[model samples]
Target: DAGITQSPRYKITETGRQVTLMCHQTWSHSYMFWYRQDLGHGLRLIYYSAAADITDKGEVPDGYVVSRSKTENFPLTLESATRSQTSVYFCASSTSGRLGYFGPGTRLTVT
Candidate 1:
């Protein structure tokens, strides 16, 4: 309730369907990041926002979209979900981008 949290802890969606995963933080950190964890990739950054209206693409931003309208909210959307996108997604927040606090995570499976 006081830290970071993710909604819909688990999700199952069909290919080509649109899905949105929500991340909310109460700490009001300046930097928020979205990462996808896979077998070989470990933890890959999908997108990150330095501020409310300033966002940037990360290492693997191909199939994912992220937006930060408020300091406490950073939501990631899959415009057209794909099977290859199935992974455990984590939302993290940090003040200096060195050490971050992560949310519980959302496990998404695209079928």
Candidate 2:
């Protein structure tokens, strides 16, 4: 079965602008999370949603926001992109207490 998918596998941009990354999944997992992977930061949670319209701030939610209005979609938006924000973003979904399935991943670079 089709799993999660993320758009713009690679991106480049100048610092300070809005950027929204799209994530979609075919499996109706109830928990979706957004995380950024960095060289030293490992995987930092940016945001997550337990279900539609129910999101909570993660460990590193600053400058980032996410919403899950549909059970199969969770989108992440950077209010103002920055160079420090450049990192590999991943979208993951899972059933409660189960292993998460990750998307292909999106690499964003800001100058």
Candidate 3:
């Protein structure tokens, strides 16, 4: 997979539960990002991992967490889901400094 891919392209979970979205890439890029898109807010970063075991919170990481144990896989977890957390989540990978290849995305709905 030269490009990025996401699992569970769509999801529906109850509030206060935990959910994880998976992402994988074959480029072995140095950067991986997780973003959620809403109606009013555009793509808002939830977290980003630079390399294995090197992750950082992004614009909106309140209820989300991310880890990069391997360069090819970056998974995002929603610790405690809420109605407000429902959105379309996108996973992307890129080299040090270049355009990122985005995954198809995983739409999560919290009810």
Candidate 4:
């Protein structure tokens, strides 16, 4: 439960402003990912990284950016926050791409 925790638990930003959500995992799983949870949409992958410096786009990558410079850290950034981007974001880590351990989740609101 405490293996991963996201910062700023909640945030509110204006449209066109930039925002970044930070995720840190103490377990150091090889694969880390960013996902957004919204009403009706469920959870959608925004991006994922297999290892340090190796990242790939996921189901929804537009308007978002991610970087993994270290195995335990993966940060997701919104290039320009939009109303549609407001949602609860989660960070998860997995060793083999199957089961994953998730963070506490960060609630982001863009007005």
- Window of ten residues with lowest summed lDDT in model 2: 8-17
> Across residues 1-111, which tens digit of lDDT does each residue of candidate 1 receive?
589999989999999999999999999899999999999789999999999989999999998888888999999999999999999999999999368899999999999
lDDT of 3 at 21: 98
The TM-score that candidate 2 achieves is 0.96
Q: Write the per-residue lDDT of candidate 4 for residues 1-111, one digit (tens) a residue.
A: 449889989999999999999999988799999999999999999999999999999999999998898999999999999999999999999899468999989999999
Each prediction's RMSD to truth: 1.0, 0.9, 0.8, 1.4
List clashing residue pairs in candidate 1.
none
Question: How big is the positional error of residue 82 in model 4, measured in Å on the Cα after superposition?
Answer: 0.6
TM-score of 3: 0.96
**Which residue segments of model 3 deviate by more than 4 Å?**
none
Worst 10 residues of 3 by lDDT: 93-102
Please write out the lDDT profile of model 2 over residues 1-111, one tens digit for every residue.
Answer: 689999989989878889999999999999999999999789998899999999999999999988888999999998899999989999999999889999999999999
Q: Lowest summed lDDT over 10 consecutive residues: which window, candidate 1?
A: 92-101
For lDDT, the strongest prediction is 1
Better of 3 and 4 by TM-score: 3
Q: Against the true structure, what is each candidate's TM-score?
A: 0.96, 0.96, 0.96, 0.95
- For model 3, the local distance difference test gives 0.93
